[model samples]
Target: MTTGIVLIILSAALLHATWNTIVKTAGDRTSTLGLVALGHVIPGLVMVTVLPFPSVESWPYLIASTVIHFGYFYMLGQAYKHGDLSVVYPIARGIVPALVSLWAMLFVGEILPAQAWYGIALIAVAIQISSWAALRHGVGRAALFFALGTGFCISGYSLVDGVGVRLSGDTLSYWAWHSVLHIFIVGFIALRRGNAIRALPRRTWMIGILGGIVSMTAYGLVLYAKNFAPLGAVSALRETSVIFAALIGFVFLGEGNWRRRLLAAVLMAGGVALIGLSI
Candidate 1:
């Protein structure tokens, strides 16, 4: 992967983690996600209105991506309801790249060079180390499982959008419409909750709005990157988001048991290094 694309993906990853951290700090998955999702729709709707619509070939992929993204948000809401940012966020986001790598290989007829394979392996090792702490904490296997489900959702969207954007021939329109549907799904859920509109806190709303903007930028960046590169490289670089999540956990959440977290961090760093060096 070119260094510029790698930087874009990693930059998006940081923004992704930043938004997740903001959501966790609020500690209200239902309201936080609901409002954020609803607010996010506005930007996408505006974009789609101004931009040309997606081509016919892209519709299937775009539609599929929308459903997968809904699943991602739903499972993420459930995961947040049950777990902390340190544990759940890593499991949710950390596990995606490996699976995406596998999908790309199995279905796309693409093969990673030996070095990229090692980089992927290192990332897996890092996730395993951090997950050990979760296992020890009696972290609900159910939550972890849900988080993994969320990971699959991530992979699904990545693969679908990877192809979809290329077919759509307009990355901005593709994402704009996809975001519109996705935000609507979440908004519908949020509207059902009584007082959801009235109960939103100004501070939390600000954080969520900021997060929404970050998320839009991240998704847009990835979509644009995929237009000119392999999905695997984009996916691999995106895992760097987990690194930011780990740091966010340590500094913002102050997760207990420093030793295990430190080990996990080292493993994640080593994994990224191995992947980078192999590349």
Candidate 2:
């Protein structure tokens, strides 16, 4: 990937970490997630009015992505309920790079370089290092299961969107539609907890919506970058969000041992460097 694309993806990673922090600190994860979905829907509604529709061929992937995202959100909320952000975030995102790489190779026919593979392996290792505390102390079994499920959902959508956006003819339009589709998530949450959602504090609504916007922007950037880079490489680099998440958890959420997380972050940085240089 070019320097420009690398920078874009990294920016997305930071934004992603920001939003997850927002969710982690929320009073009600399900409602907050619903509002986050609404955040996407509002902007998406406006954009779709002006943007071209994604190509017909991309619709199936888009639908699949939307379905998978529901599971992603559910898994993420459940994981956070059971574990710390530092623990849940790394395990959830860390597994994505390898899974995306494998899916891209098997289904998308994208073969990455040896260096890229090594970088991905390094990143995977660094991610495990970041979560060593959880392993030692034994994170809740529920947290581990839900986080793994979240990882699988992320991998599924990442591959789907990577290919879908490429075929859509316009990245922005594809993203706009994808954002709009999040309405289903919002609706699902509202249906399950209509009274609770209606009773949430204004501050919670504001924060959740803001987080949704951040999440939307982050995903959009990744989708755009996918148009220009290999899926595996882009995903490996994007998993840098785990480093950002670890720092956020330590500095803001007061979650873990900073020194160990920092070491993992440094190793991840090395992995990112290798992936960047490979292209």
Candidate 3:
């Protein structure tokens, strides 16, 4: 990976973890989704005035991505409701790289080096270990299954966004429109339930908005990075945000079962290194 992509990935790692922690710790589904949509709303609405219009060809990709992201949101909200952050977050994010690697290999006309393959295997192991840490802490089978379902949704949309951005030729507009659609879908759901708008605390709103900004920007960066880098590498680096979230949970949320988590982190870092080195 180039220095620029590396920095973008690393920076996105922090932002990804930060926003996930904010949602897991302070924000409920309504708060999290609302803030996330708001994050896109502010930046996306402003970009409408500041940036030139995207090609008309980009519309289909934008619209498809929006639908996929809404599903992602629904699965994620349910995952958060049912599982621990360490378990849900890693498994959900972890599924993205594997499926994306397979998609890139089969469809994107990209070939992975042998070392990158090794990295993919390492990533597989890291995901297992990270998941084991959650189960070791007593996360049950049902919660684990829900987290896997959520991970599948994440990987599905991530693949969509990865191809969508590169082919669309306008990452910002793709994300911007996707965010707009998210606001409509998530907002509609919240309105129907009458949960988010009426009773959410002010602090949750603040956390949601901040988390949204961090999250939207992270998505933008990853989509932009995939324009020039390998999908597997982009996905791997993004998953390091799991480590960041783990640390955030430990420090801020006072989670202390560190031995197994440390092992998972090492495996994850090694996997990322192997992938990056293959580049």
Residue-level lDDT tens digits of model 2 in 14-45: 99889877877877777888998999999999
Which candidate has the highest lDDT of all? 2
Where does candidate 1 stray beyond 4 Å?
Answer: 130-132, 256-270, 273-279
How accurate locally, in lDDT, is each candidate? Answer: 0.75, 0.89, 0.73
lDDT of 3 by residue, 79-193 (tens): 7678766667667777777777777788777778888878877766776575575656776666667777777766667677777777665677777766666667656656765
Query: TM-score per candidate, in order?
Result: 0.88, 0.94, 0.89
Task: Tell me which of candidates 1 and 2 scores higher on lDDT.
Answer: 2
Q: Is candidate 2 or candidate 3 better by TM-score?
A: 2
List candidate 2 segments past 4 Å from native. 80-85
Query: What clash pairs does model 2 have?
Result: none
Consecutive 10-residue window with the lowest summed lDDT within model 1: 270-279
**lDDT for position 27 in model 1:** 61
lDDT per residue, candidate 1, 1-279, as tens digits? 666766787788888878777776776666777666766687987897799989999999988888887788789878866776557766776677778888888878767777777776666666556546665576687788888888999998999998899899788888888778766676567567637645777887777777877787888899998886667767877777766676667777776456766776676666556555555
RMSD of each: 2.5, 1.6, 2.3
Q: What ordering of candidates by lDDT runs from best to worst?
A: 2, 1, 3
